[model samples]
Target: MKYVVGLLLALACLQAQATEEQTVVLISIDGFRHDYIELHGAPNIAKIAEQGVRSEGLIPVYPSKTFPNHISIVTGQYPSNHGIVDNNFYDTERKQRYKMGDGVKDSTWLTTLPIWNLAEFQGVKAATFFWPESEARINGRTPSYYFNYSTPAPNRQRIDQIVEWLKLPEAARPRLVTGYFSIVDTMGHRFGPESHQVAKAVKHVDELIGELWQRIHDETEVPVNLILVSDHGMSQITAKDMIDVKELNIDEELFEIVNASTRLMIYPKEDVSADQIQQLEQRLKQKQGNFVIESEQQLAQLGVTDGPRKPAIVLGTTAPATFTTRPEEQRKDGGTHGFHSSRDMDGLFVAAGPAIQQGTQINRFSNIHIYPFMAKLLELELMTEIDGDAEVLTPIIR
Candidate 1:
């Protein structure tokens, strides 16, 4: 009997050890364009690509904005399905407005579960240094280790925390970890994408990533799989290209406008009639400058579903232009995104580790597919239907 009990305990220890063998570390470098690696020179990231898998580009969802794309990458759902149509939008049903940093605590706005939430639900622990809505409790589940979003936190500190989490005991350690850096995006927005400042920011981030990579490779007992990505790219836009809706001479009471840099969402007032809305659309068409009115069919093609959050009309621009309400005030000359998916809006994707194939390059794919790919790495089953299909990225997995 004593021998049999000892054998059972040994088997249990083996199972635990097997489970601790794999770890997935997801990192997001906000606004790291697809060409940034070659243009800005990131030797560490380039080395990772050379060692593992790299993509030509990672296609962002329509209106390639930060919050929406980041959420899409983790949730595997488009903005239309996830309920965060843009960084800032008005929900007519709730009579509430959502602004980037302010609305993250409210989980009611989200319709799908992020990969972190899914991991915890499936008995695998997860940790997040920072990610959009990572601090929120979605469906009553939050990552085991997470910090409230704060720009004041140092990038190196965040990386150090992730290393600490990986060093915990097997039972307490999180198998899934996520980290985010905003310096690249911030530089791109303040200085133009082509400016020297942006290149310097990229270099700074690449060095930090290198430090993290070295520490993980040297210190951790568990093998780590690193996946790096970005929300979207940046494009230069000047104040001269700004289009003010007030120039249309429409009644302000007829609709509420949400200006999203390259796009504008117009939601008609409650009392506005269908004919009045048609008239407004006609006026916008007549006075169209650098923007074009998006029809219902066009919206659908872009994965924008009909809902209270969906605007009555969308004004989009293909050029380096922005929609604004204050035309009198000249806007700053810098970089911006939220444009329709184009070469300028393409982001980055890189994966390296035990579970990834070395020296593999794949074609451009949508960011929505990343969630399922990460889910596959963590060996977690998705609880609900998601737009992402793991099959798209299965070829890169070992």
Candidate 2:
């Protein structure tokens, strides 16, 4: 019995040492279409794909928007469960509005545990650089180190900071680090997805990634696992593709537009009569002929009805199209996401590290599963039960 106990102790020590030797870095490139890699010559990213695990695409959760999808990826829950349903949403229950820039001012909005919180609880130090919601101490626990979203910080500076963190003593070092790049999404929004500007942004981001890859290899003694992801892909749009809500000529006083993008959501005015709300819903559907007006059942099917913040009516446009409440404010030509996660709207995911399988290709997978992957890589216990099925990634990660 003593001999067996001694062997178990020896194995546990080796396991802990192994955990300390590995690092996991998750990088999110906003609006990085799965095909951007194929369209652009991103040698560093391609090299990682060639040598490590590569997914054909990462399918985002419904509404396929930024904050919702990014939050979903970390929390291992759908936007409905995680409580960030859109870039901007009106919380009907709280009578408050939640915007992307709201920061972590209200912890009550989120209902799930992000990976950083899990890491800290399990005695693993973690850090984040501009990852959505990283700044807020949700559930009264934030990452060990995090930076607010700063626009002026250069990509090189951000990478340097991460490298410095990695170089810290084991006790002080963070095993998990997350970084974000929004330039690609910015260019894709200003220009179209196929525009030269987006291409340029992609190349620039790739160069920054290459620099980060090299720095990690040169600067850190620990073996690092790099996981690259994007919230959702961008789709081209034009004036012709937009469905203008004003064209409907409905009484604006009867209802309120909660948020509008490719995905449209609206709420009836609090004092509005049920008959008035019914009329507004019909008018919206008639005006936006191309959009699918979602009923409560359909909203549930699309994973949008489970939250209190869900609007009274939801509009989902077919691809290459958008619905806008403020048509006057809409740009003439550019790109947008927030579409169903299919084909061109699917995002990107690639992993390269000592432990990741080589040249493996996952045809497609959901982004929510990423939380489980992070948990396993960091050797942290997932204290909260999450919706992500971590086993889906076991094949590639091993």
RMSD for each of the candidates: 5.6, 5.1
- Candidate 2: where are CA atoms >4 Å away? 1-21, 325-330
| Candidate 1, number of clashes | 0
**Number of backbone collisions per candidate:** 0, 0
Report how far residue 104 has shifted in candidate 2, in Å.
2.0
lDDT by residue for model 1 (249-354), tens? 6676878788787888888878889999898888789877688988888888889888999988888987578877764575778899988888778999999987
TM-score of 2: 0.91
CA error at residue 338 for candidate 2, angstroms: 0.6
Estimate the lDDT of model 1: 0.89
Which 10-residue span in candidate 2 carries the lowest summed lDDT? 13-22
lDDT of each: 0.89, 0.83
